[model samples]
Target: MKDTFTETVLEVRGLTTTISGKRGEFTAVENVDLTLKRGETLGLVGESGSGKSLTGLSLLRLVPKPAARIAAGSVVLDGIDLMSLTEDQMRQVRGRKISMILQDPQTSLNPSFTVGSQIAEALALHTDTPRKSLRDKAIEMLRRVRVAAPEHRVDAYPHQMSGGMRQRAVGAVAISCAPDVIIADEPTTSLDVTVQAQYIRLLQELQRESGMGIIFITHDFGIVAKVCHRLAVMYAGQIVETGPVAQIFDQPLHPYTRALLSSVPKLHGQIGRLPSIEGTPPPLWDRPRGCKFSPRCPLADHRCRNEEPPTVDSPAPDGSEHWARCWKPEAI
Candidate 1:
């Protein structure tokens, strides 16, 4: 087996997802590219419909079949290509080599099953642990996530747990197999401020312990700041900008990236109403020919409308480079 401890855990290129409907096929994600290393966190951030969650689905081969399909992509985890796996092969990959924590635990967890059984089932499916020890293993995993009273909580059904407890349980299930990569899709959406902090810290602790790569998908910049080591900003199903977390916060290059950071409510001081980005995201089916963000960009001009901007490099102080898809980033 190859060593995953210090290797690039996940690499994706030319990833595109197509949605088929009466209105014709729409490209949900287009030529999106990113990389995640073991023990690192890469935030996949964008407004709703910007293809954040769809990219996660495409990675897991869990896109709603018939209506949507992975048109093209190369998803290499460690040395294996996930896109080329058969359904049976992919089944072994999901929740074993890679796992996902969805946005809502209420829906992801089965109402009928006890929390411990579901976790034990995932563990049994992936490992050679004996039947009697499955329950103990499940509870141990729960302890790793800092779940309270794991032994007692193990028998509780989904409805019996509070929102925060259910979210933690879902996380325990996701990490049960100790997969190399974890795709957490808005895992804290249902959580309040305090619980959200605890969850974020717990994830960090887990990553430190397991050296797993994390692809954290969310629209919240606040969460991005808390958990992400690096960030990939998506717009119109494409990564418009990416860089070290601090650099993106201080020197956002793409107009869309800048606008997004600007829209975050200022905590240091007061301002008369928060600023908002103008214009809705263009319909995916009828996206503009050139820069998809041009319609909402204040600096978008004829060139932005007529010609697609290539990715420009912006090196950071930390020796890592930043990239932005824009024609005139300095103008922003």
Candidate 2:
């Protein structure tokens, strides 16, 4: 089947996450809106603590309790509001229709269960296959992920596998049920470059075959260029710029996005000193009154410091739409 689907699979509107700390209530994610069309890859690029991971977690309703809560907003998947679903109903959606591959595969995988058993458990929950068929299917999944000697590796525990192997194992389990959407949060973090490349290729191939909508979270703009069809640059807790990958690389709109792209290291020529965005991101509790990035933005004016920018529509050269939230967006 063609990967591209006309239907929209996921829609996040004005999604916000607030937590009550010992000090006071603070918003980790604020007024963030994103959408994922069926079978499309939306790369979410942001620095640490920018709430990219939190946003992904919120999509699955897996945010930690007590400390975290969806303060306000709606998460709709396939026309169903995920925020309104019961715990059991959400669980049914997770690992089956909507799955996630956490940042650290080594920590995410169970140390006690064999790789095969873990994958089988995920399959069993979502499928009606019998015991024997389930085991066979698990092995097939391992093979599909290109795990060498899948039959032998299936019985091996997570600790028995290498870092790359464990990640592949996680991928196998995540895709075993052929989810409609897969949110991979830094899936290649800390891995060797070669391994990261292979993992990314695996994911792309699988996504292409399964027609899965992907939300790939990463800090690397280069990685985003390689895999994502479209890109969303996040700063503080909101998407500042969103557009096609080519447009984002060629003509970035938001100042933060431009700064992020400028920071990527090149292989040749006199490597110019990477231009760093001055000033640190504000603490959630200490967010500015207007634009959160105004302190670091070179284009910031009085209005930028006093009023938040609205998302303005801008079309890319390829006819793909781009939107940026900035009072002084870069001119075309």
Off by over 4 Å in 1: 1-6
lDDT of 2 at 90: 94
lDDT of 1 by residue, 233-311 (tens): 9998899999888888988999898889888997785768777899899778888978999988899999999898898
Q: Give the alpha carbon lDDT tens digit for every residue of 52-152 in model 2.
A: 99999989988889899988889888889999999999999999989998889779899999999999998999999898887789899999999999999
Q: Best lDDT goes to which candidate? A: 1
In terms of lDDT, the poorest run of 10 residues in model 2 is: 1-10
Which parts of model 2 have CA positions greater than 4 angstroms off?
1-5, 268-270
Q: How many backbone clashes does candidate 1 have?
A: 0
lDDT for each candidate structure: 0.90, 0.88
State residue 36's C-alpha deviation in candidate 2, in Å: 1.1
